[model samples]
Target: MTRKPTSSDHIVDEKFEPWERNGRMPLPVVWVAVALAIWGTGTLLTTSGGAPETAVEAAVQQDRPVDAPDSGAALFAANCATCHQPNGSGVRLAVPPLRGSEFPAQGPELVANVLLRGIDGPIRVDGHDYDGHMPSFSAAFGDAEIAELASYVAATFGDRDDGVDTATVADLRARAVGQGTWSGGEALAAAYPGLPPQPAFSSASVTPVSADVSALIFEGRDDVWACASCHGDLGQGVENTPRLSGLSADYIAKQLRDFQTGTRANEHMSFVAKGLTEADIAGLGAYYAGLSVPSTAAPILGGDLKRGETLALVGDWDLGVPACFSCHGPSGFGVAPNFPALSAQQAPYTASQLAAWAGGHRANSPLSLMDQISKGLSTDDRRAVADYLASLPAVPAGSTGAVAKEGDGHDL
Candidate 1:
């Protein structure tokens, strides 16, 4: 009889999305917002053309790039001040002190080399032993900038008046090619006996190696280890590592460049990528792309296969997640020069990548597609799709499923 329905008579939709209950902004978006706010505030302060009246204004003057401060001081403030305090008194038992230390006082060449090629392992400064890894800034800075940074550190911390020159830095950089992070400060001290001694690992020693020794660039040169050592010889990849065999050379080179620039963060990859020059990146990319390997990876994540299959092919429109194959290509064979083949990827690697995107650890995807899509996926959803992709047959870039042909631009 068409009576008004009571509150208890209401029914929930069968397609109700659990993810919609949360209203949190993605972490990356939040960071971007904060950065914008700081910039805006700094801009307002700078336009006033008066001494900073507030603490925020003062911070903006010292820390922000307002008025473009001295290059060396600015570089140190942005990069080094976080660990080594603004005064150069470092974190206790972690990063060693730089102020009044004899370390940087060694020589302009030594300081410049340290900046060009990082240092790590145990080091003693004024009777305190500190073990810390310093990343290479070579990729981030040109010879002139590095010279400025080195000269600044020496004058400020080592109390030296002799400044490093750009030519000296350029020459040192050329000689340091193919050398990975320095073993320790001790190694440097031994290499330049004029420097102060610090206890170091007995195994730590420096033997300068030329970059020209590699028969194949993919095999690496000098202290730069071979790509095949970690990624399989055929680029099949092992566990958390990604498969590079069927990827486009352009994509591979782009990723290495991103790693070098710290756009994508992976300690091991960044270290290795920093050591690679443009030619090395191009050669390695081509070398890996040319390789063809049967997928050795298997689904070990114990995800629901039916759910995974549905997600990979059909997608959950309610949760705003698109089918994996819509962009990856039919049968997940990949769309060549852009999208990567996911069919035979290791489940662990795939799931980790999805998590990284969702957590804002990775932001390199085109138009932030992966970051957006990953945010909508639950952990179970990620594992399900990863396992499903891993279960698919691995094929060459031009081949889809059981089919084999050519002229797809990824002919292997």
Candidate 2:
């Protein structure tokens, strides 16, 4: 009877682990772990090239006072490393090397001067010549900070200790008066004969480019960004860059202000706009406003301009969308004041902006007209109008009216 009643007698162990059946993990678990480890190793190998250092890390390193502290390593990586390179090997015929070079060893005085004034023209370093321009750090860095940078360059690259003290830098700053960029290395070479003999590099000397303020628009806002990288020079819109030139100054100003204020939600434009000052904004407006509209490349976006023209001239009122020209003006040149010029816009840029408006990503357009118009159009309609706009002559022979003027409500 007892043997026959044992159907429900098999109790499972509460603390049992299938993986610990033996003394170690099961073979399958081990295999899974090995696969994970291999994957992790591969990930690390692939991700060895992000940033040399971040700004937060550089700021943190500045806690020390006396010499170039352990923090200078981060500071140097942030600033000097771009041209002289992280290891100070530098770039050929562009920038001179600091590694094993006599430049950094010529005492902190010379280094401080160069830092304050900026050096240009042919310079020899490690038996090579670099004819590149070095922008002045005087406007950017303070005495203690520049000293720390110089100290780091000498110790880390020149392999020397105790280059420039902060006090010495302050003293030099006091003596430093009017600003003029250094012309060549002749004066430096004559002054510091004890410096190491550097071999001259044989390469074409780089021509100087205008870098005052306008260059920032084309070159970079800082080392990490450039408007020209997206928008072409003269504000000709690139692939997805909106045409910036010939827009009403007020329109451009408002857009930049919106971008800065987070009223606009573009990651790229906002980032660049954040660093621009009010004065900078005004100057840029003037610069671009003065330029005549430049022609862009042919439309790569395939759309029927004829169909697009219909959308531009007369909208489908059946769908409650207004003619594109109704607000843009008869010539699509934009009414001066708030509206932007649409003539000769890039097709891709036009389409993208329209799409952004429709999706509610761009709500900064005047009167919410763009949002309404974009949402009403089908994708094909959007493409058609964008292509049609791109085909218009940027600057018509008889039309010099790219700037918008304040007036409204003459529906054609």
| Leading candidate by lDDT | 1
Candidates in order have lDDT scores of 0.71, 0.66
Scored against the true structure, residue 397 in model 1 reaches a CA lDDT of: 31
In TM-score terms, candidate 1 sits at 0.45
- Writing each residue's lDDT as its tens digit, candidate 2 over 1-412 gives 4566575556657897776656866799999999999998766555644333544466566545746346567767655653466778764443467877787877666777778776654567776654534656776677777787777777776667767877787776766667466655654676578765433333332122335445677677564366667777667777777777656555677778988999888888888889888877776665565454335734568887667877777788997887776677654666655666676778888888888888888886546777877889888888888887776545321122333345642210
* Cα displacement (Å) at residue 408, model 1: 18
Q: Write candidate 1's Cα lDDT for 257-327 as tens digits.
A: 88899988999889888887888777776666554445777778988766887887778988888888776
Candidate 2's displacement at residue 372, Å, is 1.4
When superposed on Cα atoms, how far off is each prediction in RMSD? 21.7, 21.0
Best by TM-score: 2
**Once superposed on the true structure, which residue ranges of model 2 sit more than 4 Å away at CA?**
1-212, 396-412
Would you list the clashing residue pairs of candidate 2?
127-198, 127-199, 128-199, 129-201, 335-404, 335-405, 336-404, 336-405, 337-404
Which run of 10 residues does model 2 get worst, by summed lDDT?
395-404
Worst ten in a row by lDDT for model 1: 403-412
| Error in Å for residue 47 of model 2 | 73
